[model samples]
Target: MNYKDPSLPTAARVDDLVARMTLREKAGLLFHTIWFAPPPGAETAESMIDGRHMNHFNVLGGGSPREMAEWHNALQERAAATRLGIPVTFSTDPRHSFSSNPGASMMAGAFSQWPEPPGLAAIGSAELVRKFADIARREYVAVGIRVALHPQIDLVTEPRWSRANGTFGQDAELTSRLVRAYILGFQGERLGPGGVACMTKHFPGGGPQKDGEDPHFAHGREQVYPGGRFEHHLKPFEAAFDAGTSQIMPYYGMPVGTEHEEVGFGFNKGVITGLLRERYSFDGIVCTDWGLITDAFIMGQEMPARAWGVEHLTPAERMLKAIEAGVDQFGGEACPDLLVELVEDGRISTARLDESVRRVLREKFTLGLFDAPFVDPDAAEEVVGRADFARAGFEAQTASLTLLKNGPLPLADGARVYVEGVDADVAAGYGKVVATPEEADVAVVRLAAPYEHRPGAFEAFFHSGSLAFPAAEIDRITRLQATVPTVVDVYLERPAVFPEIAEGAVAVVADYGASDRALLDVLFGRAEPQGRLPYELPRSMAAVEASPSDVPGGTADPLYPFGHGLTS
Candidate 1:
């Protein structure tokens, strides 16, 4: 049991643990499947930990802070009594955002809520990014979650890309700076039992998808760089490696017309091995993006395996290709049986399996899981979502407001305010609440920019397609402006076509994602609009259509350029 001793070197401990594990035990280490943290009656902690023999899991659908903490402690206690007593490592998607795409990320429930990643970039402060990450780290560790499946370093070059809200804007240099601070905050100077190790994701960048479609579906599988700027996307990832990220996830998009193989990054040896492993010398765990070997059921709908170019291959063949491509783990998959069969059939050597097992074991030891794995449920309740943490997040929410039009902003006190898309109960404190725009002295209207609706339950969560506002909606807003001197606050998740609204309204304010209270604070002179535009707003849909997919900034004249903000 020398591996159980904390005094031993991590390498020595990893070597001992891997040497003693059975083929099934080793195979379990290579798969990280999704597990609902809330225990929805179908799956229990025993089935996931002991029956499946899984040590690593990507947790989904969490509950209140205390409820999550108690569940984590109970789960950890169960693992501690099992044979060899290996601790579980729970990973999660970004959980502090307003965007509630179940497939992409979680909503901020009981956790402190802030604007999305683009909002952080809009503020353009590396120190602030670090502080937010550190706060997130504390909240995560409080609930026994030790892995962050985030700090998505993908550049937001393509305006129509659905995942751009998760990125640090389109500038490579700025993304790099923030990426470094983010890693440092989560993992600290060195990882330990208490730290939440960051998994920097969608390696070599996921931007520049053809026509801004995601690679999660068949129609959106191809990623092309028509502007010959493929290398431009990789700058942030290079910085991520320099900052010493614990894990990496390759995107599912297959490169088209590039020097590397025309296959998904998980299945592409040139990209995964030549570029990432050999050229970059990254020795960390490389977990392939979810569902490469099997079809996945997300939110009650079955979707095809994101095998892309390797779809013609069998499930077993796809898994083998991923192993050959130098990936150490399979995400969102639980078929350790296939890996065991592949070894027995001589398709893959046991030595290859051992390579991955060693890396997996090393991470567990580096995390100090073997020495001290269980957490205090009582302590978890006290630390998560405390008053001070919520204050910082609210302040960040206020700081992220971008004032596109400053005319009549920081509105004078005691005016009758008519609000839309904001709670009337909340707005009543600032000014007299009116029933209609006509009754009000000034109208404050908030609207989320339109996106072309996609089919299916899961796809709807991801806001994709056109960034243009419909003609009918535009006409309604302009008509309202004509009737009253309106202040238009638009949630710019995808940079909406809003030139008409910008020109018609008395004032225009752009927000990535902000609560009603935060918006009111900026409007009523309680706080300043510190955020600038992280990405450009296209002048028209024609300009967006003509723009290169890989380049930063707009192709034609932008209605509002990057870093556009006004002070009162």
Candidate 2:
């Protein structure tokens, strides 16, 4: 009855809910899984709201704000029909960024799109990062998304790491400052019921991956610290802790040669219980990175469980170990039956299950989900991706462009231009669009940070491996540059190597995630590239290989060092 009362304190409400929940219901609170959006025809029990009693979810795909809100209301209506009526907590990865890697961040659909975190880092303003978070939070809340699986504050110490675009940058102090601002913008001075809760991720930092290989794959499981700067990576999480971030998700990478066990951070008791819980005093809910307990087929590929050191254990055993390791919930896992089995067999105590359930219920109650569980579908359309938010995003895209090389000043007004990899119609707004570089006074080309091609549908999205531009690609760019004074804008998703292109191009600029209009505005001097290099651009793959994974600013004589920028 107290849980049903809106006037009661969150703790009291949580206590009431915990006392009444059955063992199966308590077990259900420990698993959070990928939520399937509504099918074209009839909907089924994919969410386990009735069959498994699971309530927490991570929404994968994008949708219009109105449709998302309507789906949420329908989903919450199902929860209301349940015995206990515990409202669902919908969470999502970064949807405001340009990165479309489904494994990392979702690309925007109807949501306002902005530059990636590194672009915010390029601008290097805590205030702007906070503003971005605030706008993103409002957009998320409007569509009934209560949890943010982001503000991924991992320090980008490893330049070749595929996940660099999701992080702030390599500098620990700078990242720490931004992390604090980001959490504040999302959760605010208090974890206000009106605000969205942040799940700051890849705890203790996920950036120092061995050989720059992502831990998402089996072959790339080691998180090495050859530079002996393991403590350096924890600075941002410490800042997150200080900022009162509501949740934590440990990374999937296993520690290679650290004092702790050589297991993934999600399954490491030393890291989670001893380090995060005891030393740092982080009492927030700790969820494991996705798919750590079970293996399944995803994106037409055989996805293996990221059990790391405990791959030898059965699924039930891995769940038990993670529970003992101080994890509150399993991310991207839905098998609450396994949890019930563990508790029924006396392998996991009821007290342990209740402990996690208490955290879960407290968050739901504190968020006011128990009091107001549904959203207005009509209100969502007007609030999300509104004009002001879109304008701010466009401005950020323009501001984040880092001028790495100085060439000719703003293109001669109405001068002829030849373009590649850009919208010709957008180019026509500023200058005469010519078909050939030979006929133009200047040429513009867009290049993406190069990656080794993988065949898998999902794996290919991850831009891992060597950060060098292929020789053939370089030759083509060189040939283009010789014909006219050319300007190159490379998408610096990961720090890319393109010395030949850099040498030949009249001007070189880097953008994390810029729109065509944003790039053109900067090209025409309508806006200044008010950004500096967030990470150093290596001169070649040789320098990238020579640098230690854990050390920041260690690339040997990088073509463009950190903080390198120019303005005409």
Candidate 3:
């Protein structure tokens, strides 16, 4: 396969392929995986095994589009049977929409189903979030996905945080101008050939947590900044490192009592080498925040205990404290032979594995993947599911519909509407869709609460040290919002109070996923809600058990706060 010389300079062809690799090919270029297992007696053995052994790290998920081009041609035939053939970047996580993580669910069966990220920041279009990240980078590089763990700009000020529907709501100047127009529409005007890279994630901000839970187990591993406003979560990660983002992951909470570093921010070296590589000069690739070096298990159970303030350190001491807290990589299913047993026990340093294998081979040589590392599985059926990308995911689910209250919302067009709790064919296209709510002139409920992954009880359901909700489904939506003029809505990927269906509705919308014709085009006014409350709405679980589990503000209050939202 004729080599080198493609007019050098992707950091000198990744430092001359890291001076011709070896150290298990530079620890298999710092581990990453996404699919490809089928070997031991083939025929998809429980979807290509995971009993752990020949493991790499990252491993992409969220299928279809000919199963992501047959799992990227079986992850490039297992990186051409590793041994320096390299090629296997892959990555992914936000497979284009409706996020609630079934390992990055992407199936509206062929991508392009936007409106989630608080409905693209309630449709305050940065050119429609860069045309939905350029049609999700042309359906993820037509099915080989070169790297985009996602645009999780994180700053929906914590409402019981179950991945606040992949944030972009609670304004920081409109999430710093739509996270720099979604990293210039998924790394285009650069980052080598046909772009993708982009990894912009959890970094210095993973919303305040603590009371908003989620640190992926261990009671949502603390991150309170109180009114210290935690440096306003590092201003949209310094506007996503001045909109160049080639990589950065950082989360796994633990900013306890702030001023940074109480451990976890991938073992904080004052937050990744004192605030993202020496005061934001970035220099790409940071990673780490997927099973932060072990002791985490889901669906197989065993997690619980980390409200920050480190304690259970083992996964080879969190992989030598995340490579002396600089971390170049190590995500999900970790075990790059514990980074080749901490570089054969001298405890890391082969010039720190050649500076994280030269920033993971300069992001696989700025993602040209050495000039195309395979893709055409029949042009993934003409660019994976393109009905104008589901009509631009139903016009970003009708401009992220919000409408908090409109008295008797635009109902009058042939009204006999009573549509409660969705699905009578998504509420018979908005009118005369009765199915009892005491049958009649306007009720329409449509709620959503379905993510019960107990995984043998993830420390009694991911913490604010004990979140709740499910009193017989909030007493069956407070007995169908006491019979009539209802219009509830909810679907808030996390954050629960419901205060008896918000003091018995006449209006209450909230969203993060909508598409029953964008919930009946914001229930009849034909789309005008402009979604807002991207996290705060507490108003009782006794104001979330009288606040302060380590800051989430006091007096709880909230029946909506983080950028409120409502505009007829």
- The numbered model that scores best in TM-score is 2
RMSD of 2: 1.1
* lDDT tens digits by residue: candidate 1, 154-174: 877778888888888888998
TM-score of each: 0.98, 0.99, 0.38
Candidate number that wins on TM-score, 1 or 3: 1
Worst 10 residues of 2 by lDDT: 38-47
| Steric clash pairs (candidate 2) | none
Least well predicted 10-residue stretch by lDDT in candidate 1: 39-48
Clash number for model 3?
Answer: 5
Model 3 poorest ten-residue lDDT run: 46-55
Residue 167 C-alpha lDDT in model 3: 74
Per residue, candidate 2 scores C-alpha lDDT tens digits across 1-568 of 8899998777888888888999988888878888756522224543488778889988888577888999898888888899999889999989887888878888887888899999999998999989998998899899999999998988878888999999888888888998899999999888878889999999878998988989999888999999999999998898999999999999999998889999999999999999999999888899999999999878888899999999999999999999999999999998899999999999999998888888888888888898899999888999899999999999999999999997795777698999998999999998999999999999989999999987799889889988988889988899999999999999999999999899999999899999888998999989998999989999888888888899998889899999888876
- What's the true lDDT of residue 348 in model 2? 92
By TM-score rank, best first, the candidates go 2, 1, 3
Clashing residue pairs found in predicted model 1: none
